[model samples]
Target: MNKLLIALLVFLFFSCAKESDSVAKKRITDEVFVPTLKIDSTDLLGLPKDTGGIHKGYLLNETEAVYAHMIYTPGGYQESGEGYPLLIFLHGWGPRQLTNEIGTDLNVVKEHGPPALIEQKQWNPSFPFIVASPQLEGQYWASADVHSFIDYIIEKYNINTNRIYLTGLSLGGGGCWYYVGEKGEESHAAAIIPISARGEASIVSNLTNTPIWAFHGAKDQTVEPINNYGSVTMVNEINRNSPAVIAKVTVFDNAGHDAWTRTYGNQFGETGISYSPFNLNIYDWLLQYKKE
Candidate 1:
């Protein structure tokens, strides 16, 4: 009888756990996400499997531990030529990994974001620059690695220090915000564009000296649009007391959680034309700013 009871209790526990997980997934889908689903499970996203510029790379931290990454260099870029602008992109959450094929890390090294744009031919190679996207193993960006990697790339690639920029979407966006706040001054970043993600509200004060162009979907559920607004509002308030800062929140109406579609794709409306300074279809604006 005791053996039967023990077996019954185990079954009940597993059943409850399964139901709980389903409910949690449903809540995320129903409340936070739309009905349909389209995300890379393999995380083999970003550049085409054949795309040449992007190569798998890794960075070593103070402990000499390796952090895997995806790196992209614009075409015709030469190490001996004038230095290229550097853009350090951070990626969002990938599908849970099934095996550790790529590395022992928890997340798959997706070729998404900047790498995807360049690989898919969405980003013009004429915009000469270097993009290094580090696949993080956690929910958010790490400042220590961010600082170390940027320094490493700048030194190794002869990147124009004045033209270094930062940008990311969702988890990456939040990471960008966090990094800019914590180490923007130290890193000497030219600007940052965070989409559908914002860090601590109070962190805005720390970025009065940084140019920020934040984007968010009005109907987003995963991360509220107000987060970006809060950062912009706070920056504006603080700007009034110091050197005026440039921070804008570009809102996408009737848009879902995937603000990145327009953010990185630079697609605004049917024409993909500039709707406002907020919604831009070009990358020159980012290049407009350079550290003095």
Candidate 2:
């Protein structure tokens, strides 16, 4: 009789475990695997494949005028139904003429091609996301038009609102500060990475609830390292007032206005600034934060 009782107990335990496993699987399927909106050709530029090559052109030309280009990498579309995160990149000044070669300029394209993160097939197929690169018009910053473009992309591609990210260099860096300070909540970006640009201290108060990671070159001459002081100081003050926000400021010694080169380029080896490594770092950092 004891042997029969023991066998019955083992069967009951396994039955309970199977039922619990089924419930957990159902929850994950219902919550995490919901179908996201499908992306069409009109939704994004560039060819179908992630490594087809970079697509360049004017995304939006309005009264103010905004010229931009983008690179799209759809994850294993057949494997995942959920939408992917989006990363918007704002470029610094380019040639005034807007020549064809301007799209491939060293400063603009440096570390952005060949082995770029966006071009990697492994990362593209597994972690599908859209990358937008906008080059501002003459004397115009990426503040106004880039923000609108971001909204357009989000609506068009059905982007996962929780995973949006922003990054820039030099003038673009300044624009990052401007955009995040002004319309960050509207964009709903997970985080902002501003390289070598100083944002307004007044705006820091507004971003006390936002996640921001700023990088600057200690020896920067063009924008100057002191420019970052105001933003950093404001961040500290705001954090003191409200300790809930997560803000980090990193200064690279012996670096200059080209801090993006180090921040974006591979840290293990010396290479010109590229988006591969920096993209990885920013995405990893961004995953930790989510909209409430």
Candidate 3:
């Protein structure tokens, strides 16, 4: 009898110990091992379908000799998985090289503050808009490669197809006119903003339905305010044909060729620059239009 009782007690102790070990192993597996198997949604490298998006810079060849830098902004919609708006910015004159121009002339850090500073300001992380700042190849103008880059972003990002915005400065201003007047009417931009330059007057015939907001420095030296003759003259001509197009011009008296500082420097600390009335106004103006 004594032997049997001792055997029974030993069996019970071993069984309980085994059960405790099993429970501990199960708990550890549940807590640590399982999460490793599950995929993280924020992993940008992971190719899980629509798991996380990306923002990147691309170099594109528009023609045989023309290549440009494309700055892509991805959408942050958690549920919809829909396409987003696009903003294509054409840089003025600098080096013909795409990366050099981007690093120097179109340096977002110099002009619009650093990316980290921008994020610290709580600007929309997923602004859902792509901005391509294509440097003109050689002595080329925005007319040569601007539209092609725009088309590329439209195709590559699978953009919203409806909402597009075009902006530029100096020579790019002239390019803006070339776009809206010559090619952009039927293109996709909801509105066009050109600073310190104007396109040919003859091209205004097709711009009757497009909205134009032009900025010029009264003191501009590189492209004089007198060039307004081309811009205002074209808008007037367009109005004569169709009064529907919304076209207006704004001139800053004390400004110069760098009217872009006023044009894009709005939003308070948006660019780490002092607030300019011009910047605030332009930002408000741009938000009013979206592609139909």
Candidate 4:
């Protein structure tokens, strides 16, 4: 009788766990998402099987022919064949405009942000998202160009459209602001993390519906802290009427321009300095919202 009772408990435990997982998945499926960008299938490359690990490639652009990119797929990606969330990282000015040679310039991209973590093998292999870091040829990344690249990549992979996230540092952070402002109601990203950059106050209305979590350095002389604070404040003021989305900002008192390192490295969460009440890392914070 004891053996039969133990067997029944084990069955019930597994059944409850499976049901919880199914309900979580159903929540994601029930969320509605209308893709903002028109997927451009032209010049799409024949991608290799996603057996996992980082793959280097270049964007097929006529005007900007030398745009290089790196993609990292977590381990066991091919086994599930499920649509995975996508994280697109835009690098700042230092890594851009390198020669089109994939062998040399491509390595510059992996020196920072998510790519750096993956290259050093510090990133968790079980992390579920596919990270795409794109290098720019110009000083500033245009929203239109970024959107075109997004269209190109979606056609090239099995991305969960509703869970697409955008993140960047410095100029790339400014690029994130530009993207949402220019796209306005048509932005495709579900959330954006802009570090050490300023957003335009005039575009606060455009960001009312978008989820924003900006970061800045208190001593940042390059880009003043007010830029990030001002924009977030504007958005929150307007949200007082509807309060659907709450914009957040984390200012590192001792830090300067290089705020992206700690953020992308999850040091904030590890050191218990995260602005989030739950001490969630940026990845966890980003995953919480998905066009719902």
lDDT of each: 0.64, 0.57, 0.56, 0.71
What tens-digit string does per-residue lDDT give for candidate 3 at 1-292? 9999999999999999999999999975653331222212232232223222443433434333245454545434332345555566665664345454444533442233112222344224223344555556565464546666677666665565665778777767777778766774466677778777766667777676667777766677787756555444555566677645567666676777776765665422222121112333443355456656
By lDDT, highest first, what's the ranking? 4, 1, 2, 3
Which candidate's lDDT is highest?
4
lDDT of 2 by residue, 1-292 (tens): 9999999999999999999999999865644342332323232332234434343344334213345455454533322345556777766655322544544532353344212455443233223456666555566454566777777776656466676778777677777777767774565666777777766666666577677777766677777655454334544654665735567666666667777755655343222231111223444565456555
In model 2, the clashing pairs are 111-274
- Please, what is the TM-score per model? 0.69, 0.64, 0.63, 0.73
Better of 1 and 4 by TM-score: 4
Measured over all alpha carbons after superposition, the RMSD of each candidate to the real structure, in angstroms, is 20.1, 11.7, 21.6, 12.1
Give residue 119's error in model 4 in angstroms: 0.3
Backbone N/Cα/C clashes per model: 3, 1, 0, 0
Error of 4 at 52 (Å): 6.2
What is the alpha-carbon lDDT of model 4 when measured against the actual structure? 0.71
Candidate 2 segments whose C-alpha is farther than 4 A from its true place? 1-66, 75-80, 95-126, 227-231, 237-243, 266-280
Candidate closer to the true structure by lDDT (higher is better), 2 or 3:
2
Residue pairs of candidate 4 with colliding backbone atoms: none
In the range 128-205, model 4's lDDT, one tens digit per residue, is 678888889887988888888777667777776777889999889888878987897677888899887766666666
Colliding residue pairs in candidate 3: none
